[model samples]
Target: MARPRKPLLSRDRIVTTALALIDEEGLAALSTRRLAAELGVSGPSLYNHFATKEAILDAAADTVVGRVDLSMFRDGRDWRGALLAWGRSYRAALTEHPRLVPYLAVGPGLRPAGLRMADAVFGGMVEAGWPPAQATRIGALMRYFVTGSALGSFAAGFVGDAAAYDPADYPHLGQAHLLARHREQVDEGAFETGLRALVDGLALQYAELGAGKDDAQGGAKGAAAE
Candidate 1:
């Protein structure tokens, strides 16, 4: 008896295949047919795993995030170091797949892996003495900065690309970029510096909050005695 047709495909396989195609041809060239061909499967078979190319791309994005090893944070390093490391790792993943950077640059669906990373970052912020609401907001800002830096770095490296970003119009930014021309303008150095600055700022905020809480508790005790 002929062996039943092997279950030939799965979502993970499809996402991995899609990412490979994206790495090869870029976001513009990715399509359901292209992905299926790359995976050695028929186009229709893709639908069983992903509803559309967008869905596949979304899955691929999440797959990239899912690959991150968050053990640095788990090992009890200070939040500053952990956050900087996380940002560096995230940027590295996107940088490795330059074509995938554009898709990540856009608004995409959040996946379980992305949510887990977000939770970890937010939890770290809270452990560092931030209020829940403040921690979430700060987490969003950090994400924005890291993503923006990655996209900018990728865009700058595009061959024959002009700085169409007229720094002339923004004197301060233009001057800053020009001044940093001699430095390693990559994401790692910038991410670490920015991350440390944020952590230092947060430290001041935390101290203020701690002082406020202590004052309030002391006031309550004094009032009880009076």
Candidate 2:
């Protein structure tokens, strides 16, 4: 007798398998037929789970971003430590699925899990005393830096990849790359150092804002004394 058929499929398994296929063969290698074949099912079977190819890709993107640990700083952890942890986790997840980086860069999907993860990170910053506006700006900057760096590093070796530009044409760019290389374990070191500096810069801004608030209060009291 033939072997028994497996149980029913779910969205998570489909997303996980899609991610794995992309990791093993790159994003260009993915397609509904390819995925179904790899999953031991017929092409039409995938349609029952995902309505279109874009939908599947979107789910894959969600799976990648969902791996980030945004709640690391929720328990009243130091603000700097929290931001650093967020940055590191973001970098690692994106690096693991470099081909998915483009989709991730477009921002998280409309899925509930995606929204919750973002709120958790931003909420942590607010709880640590960062105003919503400032927190939002700082978060965007950190993401740009981390994602941009990972994109460069992941494509560094592949020629004809438009993302890889020649440093010789840009002197300062060349110099910065040289300095980065000089640093110990440059890849990891650069991520941490850049994150700390970015966070520190934000802290300075917050301090100045606090001082301005104090000054205004003191001026108001002085005028009332007269």
Candidate 3:
């Protein structure tokens, strides 16, 4: 018996498997040795690609963030639509990797995809006439909203075994199993509802700002005419 010469390893392969391990288990579940075993390579071999476990984690996080669609931001004619599209895609990516939300929620770190996403969002809003301060806040606001939605599914908490929730002690009233049947629908519905409300509020604010600007400009023009 003998081991393969190359040990069957690639940076992509290692990162993919590592992310899966973290997603299936948790952050603590990942280790250099565990990842090597999952990839069927020597533990020391992993160090050749990544200097440390943190590097691999960073790559994995970037992969998840990369799934988000940023194309909508290019639609300068409709910033609201672009924002809604961004929020939906961002939430979808995070929902797929719920376990990783905690780490990602803290910050983007030096991840390229994450940085690009921030840039696209902030730049799009600013280009659409939002003040710089507000544009910065919008990026942060959406990240918080999307990450919070994915952190722990509210529907999942109720959708469980028949007796998981006691009738007298809780609100579900033994309906946990029933809720379980529609967990996906409930959770998705909640995300959509919250996302729409946020965008709608922002739209109103944008309109108000536009009106204020027009008023100021008209007043100045009338005075100059006088």
Compare the candidates by lDDT and give the number of the best one. Answer: 3
Off by over 4 Å in 1: 1-10, 105-110, 154-187
lDDT of 3 by residue, 1-226 (tens): 7987774778899989988998899999999999988888789999889999999989999999999999998856588899888899999999888898998998898899999999999999999999999999999999999999999867667646767677777875766677657878888898899999999999999999999999999999999999
Order of models, best TM-score first: 3, 2, 1
Better of 2 and 3 by lDDT: 3
Scored by TM-score, the top model is 3
Clashes of each: 0, 0, 0
Segments in model 3 whose C-alpha atoms lie over 4 Å from true places:
1-7, 159-177, 223-226
**How far is each candidate from the true structure, as Cα RMSD in Å?**
4.8, 4.9, 2.7
TM-score against native, each model? 0.75, 0.79, 0.89
Each model's lDDT comes to 0.74, 0.77, 0.89
| Pairs that clash in candidate 2 | none
- Superposition-based RMSD of candidate 1 using all C-alpha atoms, in angstroms: 4.8
Shift in Å, residue 212, candidate 2: 1.5
